[model samples]
Structure formats: structure tokens, C-alpha cells
Target chain A: MDRLGTVAVVGVGLIGGSIGLALRARGLAAEVVGVGRDLASLQQARERGVIDRATTDLSRGVAEADVVVVCTPVGRIAEDVRHAAELAPRSALITDAGSTKRGIVEAVERSSPRAAEMYVAAHPLAGSERSGSAFARADLYQDRVCVLTPTARTASDRLRRAREFWAGLGCRIVEMGPAEHDEVVAYTSHLPHALAASLAAAVPADWHPLAAGAFRDGTRVAGADTELWTAIFRDNRGPLMNAVAKLQDRLSSLKYALMNDDEESIRRWWSDARARRLLFEAQQPPEA
Target chain B: MDRLGTVAVVGVGLIGGSIGLALRARGLAAEVVGVGRDLASLQQARERGVIDRATTDLSRGVAEADVVVVCTPVGRIAEDVRHAAELAPRSALITDAGSTKRGIVEAVERSSPRAAEMYVAAHPLAGSERSGSAFARADLYQDRVCVLTPTARTASDRLRRAREFWAGLGCRIVEMGPAEHDEVVAYTSHLPHALAASLAAAVPADWHPLAAGAFRDGTRVAGADTELWTAIFRDNRGPLMNAVAKLQDRLSSLKYALMNDDEESIRRWWSDARARRLLFEAQQPPEA
Candidate 1:
């Protein structure tokens, strides 16, 4: 892989800024150009050295980039891709860092028909409670899994190029159909967010003041960017809804057991879940 | 506070062993006596110097100590308190580290008629995912809230002595009634555990192999020690049940909003939760 080339990252927030920082640290890009509507954030990103140069003009940022990575909120991913596509020249390999795949794929396919062949849908399974370039670490993606959802119509060379790029950043690649990806994340990611938020909301509005550290830790996900989450839940409504229903069923079972004083059933339920979680914990690092 | 008295740690598990270690670290106790059935764990505690002595003979251990802290599983607290009452010297102060309070109070009132006057109920709002003496850390309770739930009948001098002992180990004290303590914990702790476990159980049994990091992070509490938790929930059943009901009701409301595609309701729920969590996260750390 070339050590130096122009790379443009759209939406210079946490994900975008992290990508630029990672690229710069690895010497993978000569000029890391950032594009975002917030001029103040762009300036902050520059002072923080997350990017070599940045601009509010999306077209100017993408026109000459060798690689264009869209790192916008889930809601704006497709729109960002469409705008970038109009400015990106031929041979520019584009990709995304969106959590969901199907919507981004559909949006890019419809709005950026010319750049469809160059775009690869990718999701890096990593983050922190803090956001923006200031918190970005070069090794954020180290040993983390990055799922790439590529359809049959996706260009083989573009897919190969995208895989090579993420691999260089030390991310293990998992390939799956977009629908399958959505379903898995619905259970693993989206449902957890909704569950945490609902648990937080369930605190009688009057009781929120009395909540302690455990409640705060358990509901940490409830504090995530609401606009981003709303877009995700809306875009992946089908799988997310299914995941929610399944979770509600399990909760209902536990509630019934507790209500009826079914000690044996409740213990068995907890025991089974504990065993599974122990196995899962053995495989991963302490979550950040 | 003279640091020359024998300290009896009743359970000799994570919290107890950690307390033993912390006691020794501060030179606050002349001897650390560990009481538990497991000889091997007692040996480990001795080897690690968490305790100066260890034994399975609860009667002898309790009789030898000037200050006896009940660190057993919540279900076992009453039994331990009763047994200790028979053997513990007249002047020894008895305290507990149970998550719930009302049940412990009831148990103590029922089982240890003689020691009720000396008993000081306390809940140290501190713990970790790891367990056993091997994982014990002397500083675990540092800068954490330690609530003392004393009944009107509790001896003020003994309560003051216990509070000073805890302060020596570096803890900020909060006082609450047993009933209020139980209710607060149900909302802050027990309810979250139930939700985390239920979420884990909701994953299709066949899908366990495919369950990934996000699911694992979401369900981390599901991996907690079941026996200890079972004891907690069983002993604290009334308030735990109340909290679960409130949580279930909250979950149902969110489910209804999702099912009806009520975007406005969902937004309000998410925003409210996000607001509260941000507030909690931004608050200063608890005084030790």
C-alpha cells in the first residue's frame, strides 16, 4: 500500500477525527482533509492535529482525494455520500464508518449511482464514552472487528481495496450480508441501547434524582447522541423491532416468575444467562 | 482510634478479604481473622496476608475479634449474626456489608437477640466484576459512599464507633432507613441486574455462539456471581419486586411507543434519559 496519498474524511467529529488521527499516525496518508459544517470543530480538529487541512466545502475536500471515508452520523451518511460522489473523481475509492449498512447502501446506490462501484459499506465496532478528536487514539481500532457488508453487485476490486485499508489499521474483517449485519447488531447493539434508555426512563421521572452509581453505570448507553441513535433505530426499524420484541418476551418471562415467586424458574433463568455471559467475557477485553 | 484490636471478617470472599487487606494496609487492626467454610480460600487469604489468621470455626473466630464485620452473602447475614452473637464478646461491635438493609435488619432482629444492640447495619456501595480473595484490592472502598442504616434502637456510641472505623478506611457516610435503603438499591442496582440478565437470556439459545462483543458488554452484569445475587434478591424480595414492577412498567411504555411508531414519545423518553445520565456523569465524584 502507498504510504502517502490524499485522503478526505467527511464529518470531523469522533469517528471522522479518529480516522484522520489513525491515518496520520500510521503515515498512510500524506494529506488528511476534513470536511464538516462546523467551522469551530474543524478548527479544533486542526489545532488537535487530527487533520492536515480542513474545509466546509465538501466538494473541495473530496475532489482530489485518493480515498474518501464518510464518517457522518448514521442519519446523514447517505446524504454525505451523495454529495461527496458528485465531487469525487474517477478511481476514488470511497467507504463509510456507519453503524448500519442497508440504509447507507441503498442511499448510496440511489443518490450516487456513479460512485456506487467505488463505495464500500463498513462498520468498525469500537468507541468510547467521550467523543471528538481530542479523545481519538491512533490505536483505537487495534485488534477490533470491523464488519463489511458487501452486496453481490459491489465491485470486487473496490471491496478488496476497502478490506486492505481496514486491515492496515489492524481491524479484523467480518463479511456478511447487510440484512444479516442489521439483525446481529439489532440484538447486540441497537437493542442494548434501547434497553438501557428504557431502563433509565422507567425510573419514575421523580425518582431520577435519587438514582445512584449503579443506575448511572447501567444506563450509560442512554447518554449516547440521541440524533444518531434515532436515525439508527429508524433506518434499521425491522431488525431492531424484532430484537426489541424478543427482549420484551424474555423480560416478561422474568417478570412473571418474579410476580409468581417462581424461585426455581428465576434462578434457572439467571444461571443460564450467567453461564453464557461468563463464556462471552472470557473472549473480550473489559469494554471501554 | 487505637489500631490494636482484632478484626473479624465473617465471609472471607471478595469484599471481606478486601476489607481485611484494607484493614491491614492502614495498620488499623492488630489481627485480621477470616471465617469461612472453604479452607483453601482461607489459606489463600492467609498466604496473601489479607488475614493474619483463618479458620472454618465461626465461633472461635467471632469470639477472638474486637470488631466483627459480617461480609457473608446477604442470605447468610442473619445466620452469621446469630452464630456470632453466641460467640462474640460483649464489647465487640457488629456491622454488615449487605446490599439490602430491611431484610438484614429483620434477620438480625430475629436471630441475634443479644447482639442487636451492638449491630450497626452498613452497605458499602462498591464492588467489581472480579471475585474471590485473589482479586481483592485494599483500596476498593476508597472514595466510595458507605451508607449506615441505623434503627432508632441502635446504640449511638457503637454507631459512631463503626462510622469512625469506616472513615479510617476512607469512606464518605450517608445515612438512610433500612426500607429506604432497600428501595434505593432496587432502583439503582437490582433492577439493572434483572434487565441485563433478561437481555442476555433473550438471545436465541442457538445464537450463543454467534453472540458478539456488544451483546457481551450489554449483558456484563449477567456474568455476576449467581449464588451471591440469588441471596441478595431473595433476601430483598419485597423491594426488589417493587423496583422490578416499576421497571417493567417503564419498559412496557417504551415498547408501546415503539410498536405504535410514536416517534415523539420515543424522542421524549430518550431525551429525558440522556439528560439525566449526562447530569450524573458530570457530577463530582463521591467524597470518601
Candidate 2:
């Protein structure tokens, strides 16, 4: 793996803090700079040894950096990337850890064509409902899947650099187009969050205490931060709506089977579900 | 708690085997007998120290037992309890670990009004998607919720014994009517399983590898045994069906919000879900 001179991590939240810690722990960067809107949070990250330097000024943080990684929420990712373009070194590889890529990629490319050559949008498929620097961990991305949504506008060198950066943190690299990444994650991530929220709301508060493994596991993601997820939902609304409609259509079929007391059909559905879930369980990491 | 001279556990699979292990570990019973249709499985239970004895003959297993627990699938719980009533000692406490209460309780009382004096319907809110005796653990029920559904015909002494028996196994006891148990679990347990299956079935197979925490957690219960869960869904059809319908209705609200890009309403739903899930997490055991 290639070592870096300076790495600026914008937003200094869970994803940013983890990146800083991983880079610092591996001795991969000469300097790891934490940049955020809140000086207090960036100071806390510095105090906790997540970063060697803390700065509220994005320009001061990335002005001399070899790589700039933006780990802000979906809504702020493109703006931060664009801001980095104005000050970051011309040779710097600019990347982001946004959950949604198409909107950000398009927005950044539309603003400045030169920025696309330096930017390669990526999403690491490992995060918890809990957020912030407090919950960040150095090994958060180890052995997890990280998707790189590269466009034709993306420079080959910068794409490779983004892949190496995430790989250095122990992520298995995968490449998909921006639209495809959005579609796949609409079903894989966003749709499940929508379903969890709906499932959590459907159960009455009085009956929640008796809930055990099934209820707890099923509704786990409903504990996620509302503001962050709501923006992702709106940003990727088209594909998410399609996924939600498909789930409803499938539930309708099961509903009809239950209404008619069609044991054979219902059993067939359960059998398929059990087989599918087993296959998924096998593909996941042991702890997952 | 009163010590048991002998205990017969029918259908010694995951639930029955766990009960046998817990009883043996706590020295609650003199002998824990395993009974099932498969002599091979019963023998395996014995070999693994999950039970003191193994028998394919249900009558022989329960003949001299002080307590007879029917841990069979929902479809056969009533039949097993009635069989025990005919052969077990007059002092035996006849109980079941069926997920649904009203169906089993009504069937037993209808068959022999005298059996109600000994029978108690209970649902131990434990067990895993993985079945069979191999996965059984002595601590499976520790600090878990176990609801005892006592009927009007249920003898006061038998209900007390049932409560003591589960509590002895480290359960947190809750009392509800047979009908109430079905309704509560229909929302808490059965609805979640149904949603998990529907969600699992909706996602394309190729996209499964990309599924991270939300998809895995949301669809965890879909891995449950087909025959066992199908029987539960059928046995608790009225309430379960109502629960499935309510989930579909709730998903519709989220779908509309997505279609219209209604950020405010979507955030509201997510906010409510987060609060409800926090309350549930607070109530559940730490390991859950």
C-alpha cells in the first residue's frame, strides 16, 4: 500500500473519525487533519487521538493535503467536495463516503469538470445506528464491502487511489456505476430502513415489552438517526419507492394466502424465505 | 420452587432440548425424559446430555412423570398435552410451549374438561432460528420473557406451578389471558416474521451480498423453520392476518411520502420509530 503525505477528513463524524483513526494507527499518513463545522467536536477528535491536527477551516485543512476524504451526511457531501476543489492541491485525490452517489456525483461534475478528475465517490457498507465521533472505531470497515461508484468523468488514477485508500482500511473493493449503486442500495439498505420504520410504527407501545429476538432484530435499524436517514430517503426516492412498492406487493400475496388459509402456498413462501435467508447468512461476516 | 421427581419433554427439538438442558443444569428435575417421533433425535439429545433419557413412545416417556411439557410444533401441541393427560400421573402438571395460546388451550379444555385442572398454556419468548438439540443451551431462557396464558378453567395451583416452573428456569414471568397472548404476539412476533419474509422475498438474489446491517437485521426471522412458523401463523391466523394488514398499511404511508418527496412526514415516521425502538431495546435483555 502507498503511504500518504497529508489526509484531510471533512465532517469528523463516525465515518470521518474512523478513517482518521485507521489512517493514523496504520502510519499511512504523515498528518491526519480533522475538519468539521464544530470546533469543539474536532477538538474532541484531536484530544481522543483520532487526528493529529484539528481545524474548522476546510481550506486550511486540505490546502496542502495529498488526499481529501469527505465523510459528511449525503446532503453535505457534494458541497464539501466542491469546496475542497477550490483549495485542495491539484494533485490531491478527492473522495467521499456518502451513502448516495448519483446526486452528489452529478452535482460536483456539473459545478466543475476539473473536480471530477480528482473525485471518486464511494460508500462503505458498514455503519451503525449510532453516529458521531464518540461511536467511531478504527476497525469499523475491516472485511466490510465498500462500493466505488465511478463515472466516465473520473480519472483512472484517482479511482485507483480511492480503491487503495478504502482497501488500506481493510474494505473489500467493489465497483458499480452511480445509477446501479443507487438501485442496489435502494433494496439492500434504504428499503430495509423504510420497512423497519414501518414495522416499528405498526406495533403498539403496550405490546413492545413482550418483544424478544425477532422483534428486536427486525426493528433494530429503526433506532437510526432520523435527520440523516430522511435525507438519504429523499435523495434516493425513486429507487426506494420502487423497492417499497415491491415489498408491499409481496406482502399482499402473503396476506391473501393467510386470508384464504392456504397452508400449502404459505408454506411454500416460508420455505423460499428460509432458504434465501440462509444463503444471505452464509455470505455475511461471522459477527454480522 | 418444588423439585420435580420426573419431567417428560415431548418434541425434543430446540425449545424442548433447551428446557431439558436448563432443568438439568439447575437440578430442578430428578430425570428429564426426551420424547419425539424420531428415536434417532431423542438418542442424540441423550448423547449430548440434553436429557436424562430418550424415548420414541410418548406414553412411556410421560407415564410416571411429575411434569409433562409438550414442546411440539403448534399443530401438535394440543394432541400431545391430551395424550399426557391420559397416561401421566394424576399429580402431573400438563403444560405446553406452543407459540399460540388460545388454540392449544381451547383444544385441550374441549377434549377433556378435567384436563384444564392440570394444563397451562405458555410461550417462552426465547429460542433461535437454528433448530434441533445441537443448538440447545442451558442459559437460553435466562432473563427472557415467558408469558403464561391462564384460562378460566385453569386451576389456580396449576397456574402457580407453571409460573414457578418457568421462573425456576430464569424467566421473567408475565400473565395474560389466552386471547391476549395471541393478540400481543401477533403484533410483536408474528408480524415481524411476516415482514422479514416479505422483505427477503422482495430483494433480488444478486443484491443480497451487498445487504449490510439493516437488511440482515430486518430479515433475520425469515431464517426460522418453515413448518414451525407456518403452523404458528395458521394457528394465530385472525390476529396475525390483522397484523400483516396493518404493516402493509403503514408501508403505504412511507411509500407515499417517498413518492412525493415529503421530507417532513418521512422524518416524522423515522423519529417515532427511533423512539419506539429505543423503548423496546431498553426492555429487552442485553444480548438481544
Q: What digit string (tens of lDDT, one per residue) describes model 2 on residues A1-288?
A: 778999999988888999999999889999999988899988999999999999999999999999999999899899899999889998999998989989999999998977878899999998989989888899999889999999889999998899999999999999999999999999999988988888788888888767888888888889988889999998999998889889888888888888899999989988888888888888776776
Question: Best DockQ goes to which candidate?
Answer: 2
Q: lDDT (0-100) at residue A259 of candidate 2?
A: 89
Error of 2 at B20 (Å): 0.8
Task: Give candidate 2 misplaced runs (Cα > 4 Å).
Answer: A285-288, B285-288
Would you list the clashing residue pairs of candidate 2?
Answer: none
User: In angstroms, how far off is A138's CA in candidate 2?
Assistant: 0.8
Residue-wise lDDT of candidate 1 within B1-288, one digit each (tens)? 777589899988889988999999999988999999998989989999899999899888988688899998887887787778778897888898888889788778766557788788998877765678898889988877788999977888889888988887788788889998888777777888887887777765544434444465568778778877777777677777777767667666666777777777777767887887676666646541
- Assign candidate 2 its CAPRI class: high
- Clashing residue pair totals per candidate (backbone < 3 A): 0, 0
Question: Judged by lDDT, which candidate is best?
Answer: 2
